[model samples]
Target: MDIKTAAAMHRLRLISLPEAVSFLLLLVCSVLKRTTDFDAVPVMGMVHGVLFVLYVLFWADAWNRTRWSPGRAAGYFVLSVLPTGGFFAERMLRRESEASVIAARARREGVVNA
Candidate 1:
C-alpha cells in the first residue's frame, strides 16, 4: 500500500475504536435519561457526532485510496448510523488492513532485485 493508503487505514482503525466507545456511551446516556432523567445525553451526543464525522472522513479517504466498490463503500458509510455499528466497522477495517499487508508482502516477494 502507498503512504496515503496506509495513513488512511491507520486513522480509520484508530478513529473507529473511539467512535464505538462514544456510541456505547450515548446508548447508556439514553437509558439513563429514561430511568433517572440524567442530562448526559447532550454530552454523549456531541461526542458521538464528532466521532461519527471523523469516521466518515477517514472512511472516505480509505475508500478513495483503496478504490472500493460502491456497494462496499456504501456499507461502511451506512453503518455509522446504526447502534453498535462502529464495532463492526473496526473489525472490518482490521480485516482489510490484514489483507492489504498480505498482498503487499506477496508483491514484495515477487519483485526481482536489480
Candidate 2:
C-alpha cells in the first residue's frame, strides 16, 4: 500500500485496542453506576467518544485511500462496534498490510501487472 493508505491503516490499527478497552470500561462503568455508587461514566464516556471518533475518521481515510469493497468496509465498521471486535480488526488489518507488502514486493520484481 502507499504511504497514505498505510498510515491510515496504521492509525486505525493502533487505536483499535485502546478504543475497545475504553468501550468495555465504559460499559462496566454503566453497570457500576446502576448497581453501585461508582460514577466514572462521564470520564470514560468522553474517552471512549474521542477514541470512537478517531476510529471513524481513520476508518474513512483507509476506506477511501485503499478502495476497499463495500462488504469489506462494512465488516470493518461492524468490528468497531463490538466489544472485542477491535482485536479482530487489528488481526485483519495486519493480514491485509502483510499481503499488500508482499504484493508490492512482487510487483517490484516484475510479477504480474495485476
Q: Give the candidate number with the greatest lDDT.
A: 2
Candidate 2 C-alpha lDDT tens digits along 71-95: 9999999999999998899999999
**Overall lDDT per candidate, in order of appearance:** 0.87, 0.93
Instruction: For candidate 1, write residues 25-111 as lDDT tens digits.
Output: 899999999999687999899999998999999998989998999999898887777777778888998899898888888888895
Question: How many Å off is the CA of 45 in candidate 2?
Answer: 0.5
Pairs of residues at least 3 apart in sequence or in different chains that clash in candidate 1: none
TM-score computed on alpha carbons, candidate 1: 0.89
- Range of the 10 consecutive residues with the lowest summed lDDT in candidate 2: 105-114
**How do all models score by TM-score?**
0.89, 0.93
Worst 10 residues of 1 by lDDT: 105-114
Check candidate 2 and list the clashing pairs: none
Candidate 2 is scored at a TM of 0.93
